[model samples]
Target: MRCDGGKPACQQCVRAKKSDGCEYDDGKGKTRTQIMREHIARLESRIKELESPEITTPPITLFDPHAASPYFSESSSSSSHDSPGTTISLSASASPAPFPIGATADLESAHWDGQWSSMHDFPAVPQIGEPFGAEDPPLELAQMLLEIFLPHRHQCGLELHVGRLRESLTHPLSEQRHPVLMNAIYLWACFLSRPGQLYEHEGLYLSRALAAVNDAIANPAKAVDFIQASCLLSVYFLSNGRLLEGSYHASAAASLALQWGLHQIGRDDFVGSMSSERESTFRLEPAKDSIEQGERILAFWQVFNLDRCWSVALQRPATIPDSKHPWTAITTPWPQRMEDYETGEVDIGPGSPTIHAFFIHQAQVSNAIGGFSTFALHAKAAALLEGASRLSSSWSPQLSTSPSLTDNFRAFEHTITRFTTSLLPLHQLSATMPEDKYSLILIHSLAHASMIRLHEPFLDDQVSRDVALRAARSVTVVAKHIADGDFDYLDPLIGHCWVCAARVLISELAQLQTTWPPANTVDIRGELSTLLFSMNKLSSRFPLLAYQATKVQKLLDAN
Candidate 1:
């Protein structure tokens, strides 16, 4: 057995009750850099030996360079070192290694067999779409998509100047807009687009958006445009049930936000391939305009919220921790309404509150906990869910419980109680509202769903069962309300929360089949069926909604 060469005695020696058998004279007393340099020196000497022309191994057969056919099946049994070769055929066990410095592919370790690999293994490059001008995709359809997008844009973190965007779409393109951002907008439009004509062009928009986005990733210098494009793309992916793609873009956005020094207010972080002169220009002049600076601030939190939400859904670590950037350096104020910016009501550097400032401020206060407005409540709900997810996943009993696990559970419940109680009478949503009940109901449903997630894992406990059952029932009721109403479009994030709620209900239902369910549990197969029907209907527009619907369907079938 080999020891890791621990100090005093090796692990093996320690286990065997030996006192002084360990030795690391070679590794001890050297810094990591010194050890790495020594290792590199040895590797360099080995590479030189292997790369020598005199060190010959298997002889490779050369495919005729002048051959008309692409197929190369002919092989010579034996060949000399100087034989001309076009392709390599190594042993199946041999790994693909990079060519040594100043060495040819066939310099060493090449075999001359005629075995073939399929060309289909390599995917063809995707083609980019033709440029979009005013006349490309019909005007009526573009306008409709923009309308479908605008009302929901702020919720998804769009801070682009709407007036400028409106002018570019309606009037001639006098000033150039960034292609990455332009295509990203077009992509989101395609996502929300309707009618046969609009829906058919999603492929066209996606290809164009992807082409520009790839280029932007290669050099994401202009942080504002890059952040917008990436965040929008991530939201689109998440809406469509493309979680991996969403996570990738979310990570990219977080990385770009940090790299751009958005975390550090008043600091210049030059990125990408800009010349020293251009970089120096940015360094000399920070964002003197408060509007631009505030956009960056809002943009940072937008990514932060996303990072927190999806981290729970995907059961992965969060990308942007709250402590990643201290609050002292990050002094960009919370976002106000986009209209406030257009009207020039809210100044950038903390002068006076805008029309929407109170809502933003209340939702974001550090010490306060409850009785916020509808929008502020929604933001807090998101935060609470994130906290619950992190705490819940931290501990699970492999065989039996421990003090740490029990303590974590208690602390987790305390947080849930605190947040749940914080919702004052004004904050409580009503199911009977006539005009616009869906948004508020969705918010409450999501908050309850969070309660379910935190308590669902420990449903055997009576307290946890009660909380989870209540949350599960609230989800079904809200879902039924939406279905009963004539709402055509559902927010994708709300769809995600409904899915979480359905999963909670379905889990309890599944439990009833085997173990003894809670005494208060009722047979709500009808409720489950209604919720499923609603989800199935919503799936036509929101593709990810189908995921929850299908899962519930399977559970019903199994039961």
Candidate 2:
């Protein structure tokens, strides 16, 4: 019943359609709507100044020499040689900028602990013509933000090929560089660059992204970019603990994907009838090349991953339908890496019953598709977790006795066990990149969390408790690894898995308190501490994680 403190309107007010009543006392005595209106008014006045021929004053430069550069590029240091108010552009073929090389702080480095406040002191955004949305950002700023965003792209279901996107950046009006996607990327760049001046532009870029999204709805030609933008916006909201906004955008993305027949890519059979009316109107052809085709496939799966995993985390029904309805059945093959798309190594063949292949074909073998890469494994893990959560939620003492329900539950347990056991060792699976390692950790941890959820309701049964405990311990080990690493980015959903793991540990700790000398008390407490530490670290970026950490701490206090 508590407000999530979302901007413009809290989740409760949004749900009740009473956003007018949502107000915060920041000592300013203004509703969020009022504040937004005032900000819009100022921007509108600024817009008129840019448009008026009578106003010929030159724009002021807002750059600060002492602060981190507004632009990030390999040649950024060269910028100090330029005169004030000079404009710079980077070619897409320019050497890629090293991560956090010129920025004030890396995403997860020591500076993140407290130094980010200086980001506010850097400089105000140059307001001349609102460069971000009105015109494309300078190529250098665009490429820099893209680089900062790419590593964490998976966190928001982005499926664009890095090589292709970078290539498209050189072209001002490339479809790959659509306004919705660009604005969304700029918003994230601002968000992730917490110790740089770009962070100050988060609100500006977010508004532009939202505005572009609305414009995109009427332009079916930009449907793919719209879906990608929606996914990015969803994660932005979710990371800030705004579930209603997150879920709304998430559902929108999935709905658009389905509407465009992304789930049935390469399937000439079902495509004709899937959206006959819309097809006749727009006649949007399938992707023109393998790269575009691969994007469609990856986009569908990204939405699938988001819809499935997040629904479980939110304890809500999933947005994307598969197998439940003929019209919405997913026929897209499992996705390959962006590199595969660029090289034309993608599989464009029609999909077999997609989720079935993972649970049945892949689960039964240890070397299925060469042991499945981390990305593919992540999709499978999400499917298993969603399946377990959905099935378990519908269970009750009476339903548990139903043969069909019991059989389904046992089947999920079996599939998850075999699926997890078949996975390659974490060390072998992960690449040298920290982002790769973080992703590997998340999928494996999520798989274990699935087992925990499947057995959670049956904890009174000794067998169920044993299974759940082992899985919880596995998740705790992953949490420890995550806590010890210097990861610059982490998927916010990982915090939810940690919360589930913490609950099992809390139960064990409670039982241990009943006995003299409390067997394994130190070990349980250590694992619990590790989970809490990881959650708290993550909470620094995501408010929902802070809430979860607080609830767990209170449970520990009560114990």
- Model 1 pairs in collision: none
Structural similarity to truth (TM-score) of each candidate:
0.61, 0.73
lDDT of 1: 0.52
Clashing residue pairs in candidate 2 (N, C-alpha, C atoms within 3 angstroms)? none
RMSD, every candidate, angstroms = 26.1, 17.2
Q: Would you give me the overall lDDT of model 2?
A: 0.67
lDDT of 1 by residue, 278-394 (tens): 333222136545455556655766776577666666667877544422321333334443444445544233322211222233323421221233433454566667767776666
Clash counts for all predictions:
0, 0
TM-score for predicted model 2 compared with the true structure: 0.73
RMSD (Cα, Å) of model 2? 17.2
Query: Which residue runs does candidate 1 get wrong by more than 4 Å?
Result: 1-145, 152-161, 168-177, 214-221, 263-290, 324-334, 339-376, 399-439, 483-487, 513-523
